[model samples]
Target: MTDKQSKAREYVLADLVDATNEVDDAMNLLTEARYPVPAALTAHLQAAREQLAAALTIAKQGDAYRPRCAHQCPNHAHTCDRTPTHLSDHRDQQQKGTHTCSWPNEPDHITIRISGGSDDLVEVEGCEGADEFNCWGIGLTGWRGDLIGGTDTETLRIYAIYNGIWTFAATASDESLPMPDWPIRITDHPDVGHSALVEIDAPAGTRLTNVTALGGDR
Candidate 1:
């Protein structure tokens, strides 16, 4: 993986953590508010919880194979940069392979386009802003991006034209992917003149793959 990709992954992991926290907060708020849990709200809460759990699981797996630097160099030492070659040595000694994803030690943005539709193509905009210092909370607010924010006016939008849609519980590559426990909500913005196209039907054989960066310094 390039530096940009690594940074984007790190930013996504941090956002996952934030999403987990946000879901917890939302659940607590719902309970404290004494609002009767509507079926839809309850379902949404549950789905968010599960997504957060899955994200953490994936993150832990990535962390398990991630390489770490042991030797500390002087502040002025060029070797302290931790290049892929240096990390490769560490990974080899640790019995870890060299296929790990790590790069992009800076803040930037990226877009994920979902294509291969028979009729129309769907494009989702996602941010990938991460600093080189490992600071948290940069881009991709949640696993679904900024698609859940609530406002009097809609900000996010999605629509699907496919006959069938496939939803994966965890990873899309899994054979026995569990069905989505909650409905996927898509919204549109009239003031900003923006829209999002999302697939919701499960039996449509929808396949989700490929994530790309939009545009940035990286």
Candidate 2:
């Protein structure tokens, strides 16, 4: 995430915390009020609080979820540490050109692989009930494709390269709507070639679902 995006997320989290606190205060006041508070109003306020709390929890959990290191450090004899704090310090050292062997370099090849099917399509596990997903690839000859949702049957055409990485990402406001059917097609792009391999990324705790897609169909 860019610095701007990080700041935006922080702002949103702050807002959610404030909203939750306000709701708590209202509920407390109602409990202490001399007059009886309407039961319907109290229930509505409680529901809103629950939703905000759930959203806050989810926001805090993701944005850092990823597979464990694929390579081990020669010096430390352990996999690279990708914790937020360690990664931040490691990045700073790299920029300063004083990096050491704290973290091992990422493998040139993809650590997690999506088994490809006919027509260059692949099934990305852990996508059922996901509100958003990010697809990235290394050694990709083609950079454009479409993502078809399994349950909702929605198709998202994507083409982009972020920070020099071939990437395509999407989000849905309706969290209830599950996106991406099990096997999503990677349309052939003769202009560039085709996808060699891909890594599918969904938010942490996303449920896994399997489905079949032939030539980008159900």
Candidate 3:
């Protein structure tokens, strides 16, 4: 399993155990009470019981909730000892040069390339129709893609790439704008390609060797 998944499972289990203990304590308090049970206390006990039941349902799913690791290390016998090799190593190799791209309307397609000084070249492209109007931007810190409409509204699925890996990607849309002068309208579809480029931190002593175009859904 991935480290993030493992950590999430651990947190859920810990929360379940604590909820169970609270339920048990509430039950004991009810049984040993010398006075009539207060309405508020009774309501709290009921709530705790319900929460415990819900947590138990999730715990029973077992492997369905926690799957095995999809990728395995090939060089287990190597001298290198890294906890998370894939993510850690990839980030370490991306700090040598600047990765830049231009976002604008294209008649045929838009191509983005990452130059990895003497290393492999990474390129990504998106196509536009013959008559269809296309305008989009690259989101350095989040997911890349334009919404359905050309409105300046930010949506979820935008993620920030940190330490050479994608992280902190989330989306939120609502009826009212949370803050005034927030460039993106809450109701309009988000046009997110012109935002600031995000910088990622690289581990010390690691040099970027190559960048290959990642082909797939962002």
RMSD of each: 17.6, 15.7, 20.5
At residue 55, what lDDT does model 1 achieve?
Answer: 56
lDDT of 1 by residue, 64-172 (tens): 2233344322111112444555665342222233433232222321222322122122333232321111111222222222222222121222212111221111233
Q: For candidate 3, lDDT tens digit of each residue in 26-145?
A: 679888999898887677466546434443454444321232122312211112222554443231212222332222233322221111111111112221211111111121111222
* Candidate 3, superposed: residue stretches over 4 Å from native: 62-218
Ranking by TM-score: 1, 2, 3
Candidate 2 Cα errors over 4 Å, as ranges: 63-218
Greater lDDT among 1 and 3 belongs to 1
Q: Scored by CA lDDT, what does every candidate get?
A: 0.34, 0.38, 0.29
After the best TM-score superposition of candidate 3, give how far the Cα of residue 199 lies from its true spot, in angstroms.
28
* Candidate 3 Cα deviation (angstroms), residue 92: 35
lDDT of 1: 0.34
| TM-score to native of every candidate shown | 0.35, 0.34, 0.29
Q: Candidate 1: worst 10 consecutive residues by lDDT?
A: 129-138
Write the candidate numbers in order of decreasing lDDT. 2, 1, 3
Q: What is the lDDT of candidate 2?
A: 0.38
